[model samples]
Target: MNDISAQAATLQWNDQGLVPAIAQDWQTGEVLMLAWMNREALELTVREGRAIYWSRSRGALWRKGEESGNVQHLKELRIDCDADTVLMKVEQVGDIACHTGRRSCFYQRLENGEWQVTDPVLKDPQTLYGKS
Candidate 1:
């Protein structure tokens, strides 16, 4: 048996010990982004009342908006029927959720079977991240 945190040991984790986490705008019901969460990340998020996720790319726990000022203040956390996915209602600070300086990561739409960018960049990435 895999050792899991007592706080989220009941959650149905995937083979990688991760569960999909979806962040949504609390007021508007807009899904900001989908990230992954491990036991520690989930526990931290719940404990801190903020969005903390496991960064597969970085192979570490990443607090949302740790680099940028756009933090997702957790309002509510809910699990799916299968307990495989976590839905978070959050107050998205800075009004930007997407890394590309958009409001949400889901700014693309499938129009005529082609992916089209539907959202505009509110702030330039260079300015937000202090990089190109």
Candidate 2:
């Protein structure tokens, strides 16, 4: 834990005291999702070996899969050269990473100048989070 804190101290957090964390598939190297991590959230993620993000909307620490069961187990964590961003190589449980039930958050592509969703939802959000 101390080691993680020492490493995290080297990161260049933004004015909001958060860094952008990019989660990637450990085996395939596909990017999953982008989230924010405050100091505590980052530390907890390292300690817990799972994805823990700071929710800008709810203003709290969001434990990935707490509601949806799409938790990302941390395989490796890296800091960029500029120390402004974090990369997490994770094993995504349930094979879903997006709240929209897609495999990745970046499942949209722009074709002919029009944004289109290029991936299918592996599971329904309502099925995971319950109707509400």
lDDT of each: 0.90, 0.93
Q: Whose lDDT is greatest here?
A: 2
| Model 1, runs deviating above 4 Å | 1-7
For model 2 the TM-score comes to 0.95
Per-residue CA lDDT of candidate 2, range 1-132, in tens? 425888888899999999999999999999999999999999999999999999999999999999988899999998899999999999999888999989999999999999999999888888868875
Across residues 1-132, which tens digit of lDDT does each residue of candidate 1 receive? 122256487889999999999999999999999999999998888888889999999999999898888999989888899888999999999978888999999999999999999999999978888776
Estimate the lDDT of model 1. 0.90
Error of 2 at 74 (Å): 0.6
Per-prediction TM-score, please?
0.93, 0.95
Question: Where does model 2 exceed 4 Å of error?
Answer: none
